[model samples]
Target chain A: AQSVTQLDSQVPVFEEAPVELRCNYSSSVSVYLFWYVQYPNQGLQLLLKYLSGSTLVKGINGFEAEFNKSQTSFHLRKPSVHISDTAEYFCAVSDYGSGNTGKLIFGQGTTLQVKP
Target chain B: DTAVSQTPKYLVTQMGNDKSIKCEQNLGHDTMYWYKQDSKKFLKIMFSYNNKELIINETVPNRFSPKSPDKAHLNLHINSLELGDSAVYFCASSQRTGNEKLFFGSGTQLSVL
Candidate 1:
């Protein structure tokens, strides 16, 4: 079974401040990590995904994440955040094994509230 | 243009009712999926179809059934809806191989009264 855990349910930060949303996963098979953002009343939009190679991956809106294998974690980070960045973020895991169709298991989601 | 679209963006029905949520994707992907986001904001895969063939069922309840008329369309039908059935149902499509990112619809917010 594949599962993802978002440690923080809600994160409040000031504008222009750095922020990190922690995520951890557990899977018997190889897994692909992804960060999806959901604006108010909207569906999830893909932020970035870590498939292979470098441990650090960059995504849209100046966001990035580093995948730590030994720690079993993929934490999302941003050097600076804007008011527009306030939204709900979800950490998801997908089975990367061959012949496996795309089935994404998502975490509970963390609400990022950026204050001016 | 909307890459993926679902009809009846909001659904409010009484308990024990039967309803259906229709989804269509124009991205020309061969695989589509249905996901349910519960009140707690946990997104779970309900079903998946590749080339209009069932690929994953995820042990969803028999009350929930999915139909894929073609690769571009996948519809979900619910029977005997209960209060616990209220959720946001998302329709997504993808290449089914080599890629993991999915194009998702706005979702149907179903509220069973």
Candidate 2:
């Protein structure tokens, strides 16, 4: 079975500061990785995905993640964050060859607290 | 218009009671899924349907059932609910199966007392 692990449960950073949210996954076969953001009282929105592309993937809101196959990591990074960037972030993975079910296994979320 | 929508943004019911959550998608997607988000913010897939056909059913209890009346609608019904079921339920859809980007609804927060 595939599983995802988010190293940090919470990340606190000041506005205009750089931040990184760590994520690692364990899978027997190839997988598709994704990062999603969820604001308060809202559904998750896809930040970005790595699906047979370049190692570095850029997403909305100036967020980017690098897929490190050797390390089994896909850490999200932002050069600078804003106050509105405070939200719950999730890391998810789905098997590349799971008969097209698209079932996602998510890790425990990381809360991004942006302070002024 | 909302690409994906779920009814009853919040539901409060007593244990042993039954409840239903409805979902619909206007994105014309063929695949729909139900995901449960626990109190710890862990998300797990519970069920999925494609073109009104059940394709994936996780290790969910029999008390929880899903019905898809059409390709655009999927409804989840739970009988004899328990406190453990108190969590946010999300409905999502994809243009197709296999690594497609999923669109999620706002979610239904169910609280079982």
Question: For all the candidates, what are their Cα RMSDs to the real structure?
Answer: 1.0, 0.8
Q: Show model 1 residue runs off by greater than 4 Å.
A: B97-99
* Residues B1-113, model 2: lDDT tens digits: 99999999999999999999999999999999999999998889999999999989999999999999999999999999999999999999998777888899999999999
lDDT of 1 by residue, A16-112 (tens): 9999999999998888999999998888899999999999999999999999999999999999999999999999998868777777889999999
Q: State the displacement of the C-alpha of residue B40, model 2, in Å, after optimal TM-score superposition.
A: 0.8
Error of 2 at B108 (Å): 0.6
True contacts kept of 2: 0.82
Shares of reference contacts reproduced by the candidates, in order, are 0.61, 0.82
DockQ of each candidate relative to the true complex: 0.69, 0.84
Please report, in order, the local distance difference test score of every candidate based on alpha carbons. Answer: 0.93, 0.95
What's the TM-score of chain B for every model shown?
0.96, 0.99
What TM-score does chain A reach in every model?
0.97, 0.98
Each prediction's TM-score against the native? 0.97, 0.98
Residue pairs in clash, model 1: none
Question: Model 2 clash pairs?
Answer: none
